[model samples]
Target: MDSISQLPDALLLGVLSLLPAKDVVATMILSKRWQFLWMFVPKLIYDDNYQNIEFERLSRFVYRSLLLHEAPVIETLHFIIRPKSNVVDIGVWTRTAVKRCVRELIIEMDCSSSSTAPVMLPRSLYSGCSILVKLKLKKVVLVDVTSPFSFPSLKELSLKSVKYPDEEFVQSLLSNCPVLESLVVKQCPNDNATIFTVKNSSLKSLVLENQDLRYNDIGAGYVIDAPSLEKFKIRDLHEDRFCVIENEMPNIVEADIDVAYGHPGKILSSITSVKHLTLCITSSKDAYPVGLAFCSLVYLEIWTLDTEWSNDLNLLMCVLRDSPNLRALKLEQLDCDGDRSCWMEPSSAPECVIWSLETLELVDYEGAEEEKKVIAFILRNANCLKKATISTESTDPNKRLEMLKELELFPRRSPNCQLAFYYSP
Candidate 1:
């Protein structure tokens, strides 16, 4: 105990910062030297489920700790409020954290178990806190703000299941953050914003996950104008929505798009410069725009759905034809219940298969007749192919051996190509 106590106060506070707020405060009981050490810890995390404490007790503890904390700058202030907790108390806690120069603030409300309404954050939060570098809010309501404010230091922001007042408010809030580099938005059903517009020039990464369950014919969509984006991801399961990109992302390095939208030509044309892409669309017939080429695409992953085989094959051939520099390809069979349609070979091999293609992977391989035809065509045409891996979920050893034997009989154009098989199940 004496040796531990001899360590510097800064080192002791560092250790306390890793623990929960309640545990940090309990360290005061160890010795007189540690009595006031917890007050200087830069990070405070308070979760109601941590100790199963009552709401009232947790509220009081947060209030008292903020009042006594002596840190000049709170690096992080995280809170997980219970559903029935007082909104006024939450406002007070946020105001206090802002005053303490909190850099990273996270407030998550658990509303899944209770029928209480979403907690509206204090207006002071939107107006103040110029020093905040990162902010994350979940299950909260963002009311309209008339006051002018800007988060000059904020670089990362995440909003999950948040309710917004209107489209203007959403645009105004994003416009205020001039230098935000990363943004994540998970939309809720009927959240009032019909078209979410993000026009940030400095944004380098963006993730959009839309869970909107509205069945009406009223169209909902997104307008993205982030030209500096290096990485982009979107997962929209609703087929009624649309996406419009205002500018091309020349610097984009990777993208993951899984949408059910009918026509995604505009979205596809904007991301032609991506080096690595993962794509899953509802309809692939109109997947590419006219004269659009993926000159920079090096790695491609296509998620095949349980749909018409001809459409899926057409999409695959169209992309492979345009991606002249593609080096690696992955086909993930999400479902294998499609019709066993006859496979028709392309008139000519794609430039990628004859020139740069090196690695191929087929996940969830079912060894269907159509699947075998597609695999045989790639092996016969890919002159630069180095390795091919087939992962199957079949449990029968005899079926697996027969599948391997069929694949081995296919003619390979590359002399050094190695074929490997795995039974996943």
Candidate 2:
């Protein structure tokens, strides 16, 4: 490979830093240290095929290769602009030669018509304690914040399909990012969510996807008030004004929600300190909201379908009187009716006969016998129950597993529960 332009300029600026800075400035006549190591390669990846070229010859070769780079700390400046109109400012002279050693700034623009022009962010990046951790933006719009900004070692921040309709400029750009932890906002605007009221105790992983959030209107405050938040994910909720118990963000342990209308229900103020909860109920609920509680939920997954529920046994007896630290429970596509009476019976069978349940899964169960006596009254009252699995798709499978082995008044596993039967022909 000695023929590879006689190699070395740190191996041809690491293969022209993966090409395209106009093909690494045409590999600088392939000599003279690749014409000064392709303007001091520190990562400035740009794409969108550099937009049909010729934006004044691509702004005079990225402003003469950032003025023949004398090295000013450029370590990652990815751009993928796709603007045809909006009065083309052409990213204001290559972001003013990225003055302060730009430490990671990615902007992925895509404008289709509509022009007012005044949006050219990348100025008040990071000062004082600047380490510019990591920032990802899509369809970005942060019209320069007046400049007392800070990035005191910013952390992971991802905002996709953005649109910020001033909430004091999104809380003055998140109150100057004072040690912002992992925060991801997908599909924003209409107050482009990230509304943390004062208390920023160093946020810890919060994500709001496709949000229409309206929080901290005081009294019913908080879009986020991280007391060291712990992994929270809210996915695509068109509207119902994005409520998570009034934007409390309760010291989450881990939660993934998708809600639009659980009504005066999603008022989940205190999650009893979550422990893995995944709820993907795409609206159309008949009942799953009786002031739902998680009482320290411990692994509970419900995808929903019991005929889209009308009360799925009063939402499974409100998770047995509010999850007494539940221990693994998965119910999917449930909708039984062989006279299991569909809950509400004597207060949901004394809240599913008291719990602290341990493993109870029923997927697509339909061989109703009162849903097999509510899975044998939750294995004869979940006294630290161990197992109960019933799978059904159906196929003369021992007539629904021998009609659950001839009912036998419940006893498939008692010395601490354990009964398995899967059917899928």
Candidate 3:
């Protein structure tokens, strides 16, 4: 135990950094050296989720920690504050505490107070946030002030359950984060008349989920100009005008397009470079692998379309012709009806088949005759296929065994191939 206590103060401090903030406070009693070590920890996380009342105590904790410690450079600052109570000079005190050491700041504030309106943050708190490289804000609201906000060094940002003063404010925030690489916005709406102009070049990942906008507003004409974007996920419920559009994102490699039914062609038309694509469509004709292509596509998942197995077959034909390098295909949550005729392509259609296809996975498969036909078609064309995963609902023993028997019949021309069928409830 003597050797243990003799550990360097810095190394012991590193151990405490991994502990929760509450636990770190308790370690102050470990020894006198530890007491000073906790003060040097570069990261601080304060979670008030356990407290249902106001976050008045959180301000006190910060005040005490800052007064006692003289940390030269802080790294991460996280606070999830509960609403209602007031603390004197909180904005200024918090701002001073986060002068330079903060490279990442995550603030989750509960702003739904019963009083007049949610309390606004003081202008000084965000003055130094430009140095923050990552930020995740939830349920927080900020007002407009003469101080034009800017965060020039931010790289990754995720905003959830939060609101900006206006749509222009949102765009301004995006513009200020010049080198931002990843952005995620969910369940937030700006003023009705405001327009959010999105323009960034370094953004590589973009996710717009649950964009709640008023009717007839047609969503602030979003213009994405990120040429290096490699991944994109769009989930929208409000079917407004299907005003969705995809700007120049040629580097996209993997994407999931979840569309609302009324908006057929809402998804962007040009995703030619995507290597793996998943379409969550409700209509058979809602989308077809058309002019846009994925020559390097190695994996594809087409889910939530018509129950006709033939529809999948026809789409695969288009994909095979375009993506000659396609290998693995994953079909999940497919509800296909017994329609056998959709499997064949016209004689004039370009020859399309997965010559190198190896692995196939079908989740939630129902043993319809036409569905089996599609499965057989894959087996016949993909001469190099080594294994197939057929998963079905297990609630019914008869249907589960039925699928296993039908899929077991596919002649594994390449004995090197094996089929694994699973019945998942």
TM-score for each model: 0.95, 0.29, 0.85
Candidate topping lDDT: 1
| Candidate 1 accuracy as TM-score | 0.95
Error of 1 at 379 (Å): 1.3
- What would the per-residue lDDT of candidate 3 be over residues 51-115, giving only the tens digit for each residue? 44235666666667766656676677766565554524445555665565577777766554453
RMSD, one per candidate, in order: 1.7, 17.8, 3.7
Q: What RMSD does model 3 have?
A: 3.7
Of the two candidates 2 and 3, the one with more favorable TM-score, higher being better, is: 3
Predicted structure with the largest TM-score when compared to the true one: 1
**Model 1, stretches more than 4 Å misplaced?**
1-11, 111-116, 212-217
lDDT of each: 0.87, 0.61, 0.66
The runs of at least 3 residues in candidate 2 whose Cα sits more than 4 Å from the true structure, single-residue gaps closed, are: 1-156, 159-176, 179-182, 185-200, 204-227, 230-250, 253-272, 275-295, 298-324, 331-361, 364-378, 383-425
lDDT of 1 at 173: 84
Worst 10 residues of 3 by lDDT: 345-354
Instruction: Report backbone clashes per prediction.
Output: 0, 2, 5
Write one digit per residue (lDDT tens) for candidate 2, span 1-425.
Answer: 33876766666667766776777777678666466667777676655446577555665666677667655676776766655422234445335534636667677665553632323454544343266677787765665445576777677778776666454666666667878888776654443444433335677887766543533232222365566778877765544344443346667888776555444145344444778876665553453555556766778776653443445555555656777667787777665533333443443443324456678887877766556666776676667777878788877766776766654458533476777777755
lDDT ranking of the models: 1, 3, 2
